[model samples]
Target chain A: MARNRVGVIGGGQLARMMIPPAVELGIDLRVLEEAEGMSADLAATGVGDYRDLDTVLAFAETVDVVTFDHEHVPPAILRELVGRGIPVHPGPDALLYAQDKLQMRAKLSELGLPVPDWAAVESADELGVFLADHGGRAVVKTARGGYDGKGVRVVTEASGADDWFLALAEDGHGGALLVEELVDFRRELAQLVARRPSGEVAAWPVVETVQRDGVCAEVIAPAPGAAGRVAQASADIARRVAEGLGVTGVLAVELFETTDDRVLINELAMRPHNSGHWSIEGAVTGQFEQHLRAVLDLPLGSTAPREDWSVMVNILGGPAEGTLQDRYPAALAAHPEAKFHGYGKAPRPGRKVGHVTVGGDDLDDVVYRARAAAAFFEG
Target chain B: MARNRVGVIGGGQLARMMIPPAVELGIDLRVLEEAEGMSADLAATGVGDYRDLDTVLAFAETVDVVTFDHEHVPPAILRELVGRGIPVHPGPDALLYAQDKLQMRAKLSELGLPVPDWAAVESADELGVFLADHGGRAVVKTARGGYDGKGVRVVTEASGADDWFLALAEDGHGGALLVEELVDFRRELAQLVARRPSGEVAAWPVVETVQRDGVCAEVIAPAPGAAGRVAQASADIARRVAEGLGVTGVLAVELFETTDDRVLINELAMRPHNSGHWSIEGAVTGQFEQHLRAVLDLPLGSTAPREDWSVMVNILGGPAEGTLQDRYPAALAAHPEAKFHGYGKAPRPGRKVGHVTVGGDDLDDVVYRARAAAAFFEG
Candidate 1:
């Protein structure tokens, strides 16, 4: 008879989307938001720094389980919650792979997963050897605190990353740099899966994701022309990663389809990722709702597709010509079937403000409508 | 661009359900909730009396348009808002029919809509004459403040309603009683429609609703065995009512399938109704979202069914054995495809706390799953 309260750290759009489903499932969701007027402020939000042990511990004490909106929280903080016997989903051990690139690459390779050729580089000399061993060019990235094209660079020469190596050496953060062979992929795809503490797993149809400048812009469900074998392989890879890492919530595995038709893992997100936003309107049970059920250790819902095709287009901040409300009339009239989702956030250029999803029997029509609807909000 | 602010009065489950759609449409929805910790307290809620002109006017001044979660707000208060030039959806001119049954009967008759044989009675003598002209039996009802099964009676003789007639005469509220011939109908049906001020209207497929003690217990979308002619008739009747009344939001028309194979109007509601709750998971767009679009004069979304069948069963409060969260695991495990919606209210016997909807290719299977899932929460 006691309430099943789930505490979420880092209030963002992900936490906001979880509210409806959490209400439906009769779960009391309390959020530890970063500040006043954050995306999920509609719920019982506590303003505090997620990295502070006392702040997180206070938030953790109020709920039956603890989860997160992002992976930015340090592993030490998460371990502290575990040390207090608070149930933390995607425990610090599993989340470390998402937070640190070098750890993810080493761990995935140890498990024999298909990852691009990669290595840890502590100095300009190490970067030179890794680049030369591949194609004389590599993508170098910081091990942690990098997102949306930040803390990343393409280096053809060792000196290109000499400044980063020096900064890492000065900071004294061991295992700070990692490099990977620049991949020539034909397209990008994503596999979404949810796992529970009981070890039950559910995988949704693999979707094709489009990126512009390292930010996800669009997604097409049940990737067009993707062979059945390819879909099966993608699901298998995501399932293996979720189970092997002991992930107890939603996991997103970004993949690349090389020109030779091989699927290789690109990156990993341990929470509800942007790639699965289309599922909110296209799937039988949306990824947000599934995340709540999984974190609570309840039975997972079906991940079956509700339509033959579904397309999602992100609404990024544009020239600030108008607010989203100004475009609702035209956008809604243009595509009556498009479902628009706006995060209650102030718009900033190139920032993700909302998304539009359209599903139907035809792929092209759905994609066109979704794109057109999103365009209105951008302008 | 300026934000579109919608002010809603009388916070309840209907307002609670509207929150998701309002958020999606990028509109700032502020609710004048009746009390703290009400169903829609999670939204931007202001506590006040909806009946007080000053309280209502103060709330009205902050929004662009005004609507209601219930129709109990006095017409004078609505007229006062209109006097101030604030757009009130289902304005006083139209909401009168929903507040008074006698007025609704007279108006529907004038519009040539099919309603039962009825007449107003000021005293027991008039009731006797009406009953004698009929089959020696009639149904009596108060003109206002009636809901569910309250303020209604089946009287076979004049003396059976003597007390009510005497009270009506003494109160000085003239013609407080109306009598209609007892209707012999085969079943009940409901038609849901949304209309914008631009004269655009969208109607969902007619549904059959089951009632227990005048409370809606279940609903079946695209009602099985309903002839095409009957479905069209229901939609036409509902559309005519919406247009004729100048309704600016969702309208629900409860009807009776007479033994002579005809649809007759039974009741009218000017806002989201229980019979259309199935649309939340069954149709391309839900009644809540459609209502927002209509009130905003935005283009309405498609009302096409997402599947061949959808069944919704209300979770009426039974013996309060446990909280809804305690039953979620068993219910979700048993029916993974069923979508549950809880109103976040304390459960009491016969009160509507939540509902479960299931959509699929098979009617019997969907119905079974829906009923079973609802039953789990009831106990």
Candidate 2:
């Protein structure tokens, strides 16, 4: 029998979460991990540099299709994999937008998608002009290599990104920083969608997300009171972003719901994002399972919510002294209904080590339980 | 931080299913498989004879606790591990009952548990007397090594188990065959429970199980029409059995719901059983996760059902000509809400290779979808 195998390019928690659904769907998932004892260690068949074309090529050869754990796999390597006739989901063509914020801004603008007023500034003078045109303050982000609040800065002056500019010049690879107006928004919302190569798309309801220290802290599914407009607009924008970018696999479109009721794209992720983690226990089909189906070009599962409310809270920085297991007794005893998920990693300050999700009829109660369960891991 | 690791002694589908929850719970699970490329091959750390004390001990010594995928491990090896102070859930004494039908029946009878009239017959003449007393119709089963109808037989004559008796005599081991009066059951129900070493217990809703040729063919959670009496009786029976046998981890109590409004013990499994598989997609906490917690002595999760109705149907004798993936396109497209699960195994007649579960408000629709989805694998 010809077993269908899907190869993942990075060994992060995303890859680890995919193991369960893949196992259930009977898809043989193998991972090309970045290092030993990584999150997806069980499925890590090979540990080597993802940048090294030869190492990735060897791993890709063993599977029917290749997907990703993150958007960091060098586009050059991904293009090479495609050149060799190995299928890559969210192919390099679409991935370029996710890899570079400047590229994403240009593409979204060109596609006429709703996005913040932005410009690619290669010099301080350009950044100054954009800042003056919008407000004295703007958000400055490096074109590449940023995640979980890093590589992002709220700049009041052109000199705010002076260090980043100096580093860019030192690297000898000329690149521009993406500068955008810091739009006043009511709240942050995210729309998660999965697209198959065959153009089939499945979108979950828009969710409200709370950010602390620029990292995801909590998510409430369906973005309460978003039934008529917010939900419709967010889903539409996400579908457009996924279709416009020709992205395959899960696409998370982070949106800023302006004070004036306008929805604008804030960030784009071509892989399963933190905003969709609640779906593991809330949705009929989770983002991880849906991502696999999209990448494999299989029929997508239902995206219906299993309950009225599903709340997910991130367990950041884990424990101050011990592992997540040290707090399991207290957390588990407190909330048996909340599903606790821990990534196998040492606790580090500001690190997203795990998450807790609670789904039920009452949003307030669900939110409280999820937060209370995750709080146990704080120490 | 100290990591909690649990070692499993078998590498069947049950072991494979446990990997997902272990990953979610952040428990390190290592399996000692019986062969290369088994269902739980992803977690297989060692492959050796489970009957061998050295092999079992070496594997058991690495983890915080020891459990099983099946109840086939030798008692001597398990006792040796217990002697070495290794935490073994459903320890040797408990497993012995599951291993020997006569022992289980005698113990249950001694405890005054509800069971059919039964006796242990060593010879054909003894069996004849018992059969005559039971209106010349009795169910005969070997004392040990029985599963999925392999070691059981229904006889109307004295010579029905003559061959088994002959083999027992030839082996030079004195053992009696377990015989019981033919049960006129209205339906079969299963009560699943998880018990910790500390004596905490959690029980899922009793589920109606359909058996085809002595193999679990389908399951309906909460057993339709079993609200007041049947539900209470089944749960009480299961808890008593678990406490009486000193069983830990998940215990499956298969019951015969007779036409006369009586529930009798049919069989006992000291680990996660096929009857509880539906909980993976339907319950607030799956049996696999509950089993892991029970074995590790952690607080158990809720056993609440997530939906109104969740129907599960087994996929027996998977595609004969191609892999399970060959039928995925059709099955997946037709029933997107139905969760498909395939065990990584080759197709063989009457072999359980996979299952499909559908959860929704309507039982009839859910049952139809689950069965239809599972039928696509028929070859």
- Candidate whose lDDT is highest: 2
User: Model 2: residues >4 Å from true position, as ranges?
Assistant: A1-3, B1-3
Predicted candidate 1 versus true structure: per-residue lDDT over A1-379, tens digit per residue? 6537899998799988888787666578899999988888777458999889889998999998999999988889999999988999979999999998988999889889999999998888888899889979999998888887788889999888888888887887645588998988999999999999899999999999999988999999989987498899999999999988888899999999898888999999999999999898899999999999998888999999999999999988842876777778778888888888888777788898899999998888888888888998875
TM-score to true structure, per model = 0.97, 0.99
Each model's lDDT comes to 0.88, 0.92
What CAPRI class is candidate 2?
medium
DockQ of each: 0.70, 0.74
TM-score, predicted candidate 1 vs. hidden true structure: 0.97
Candidate with best DockQ: 2
In candidate 2, the residue pairs with backbone N, CA or C atoms under 3 Å apart (3 or more residues apart, or in different chains) clash, namely A320-A379
- Candidate 1: the clashing residue pairs are none
Candidate 1 residue B137 Cα shift, in angstroms, is 2.5
RMSD of model 2 against the true structure: 1.1
RMSD of each: 1.7, 1.1
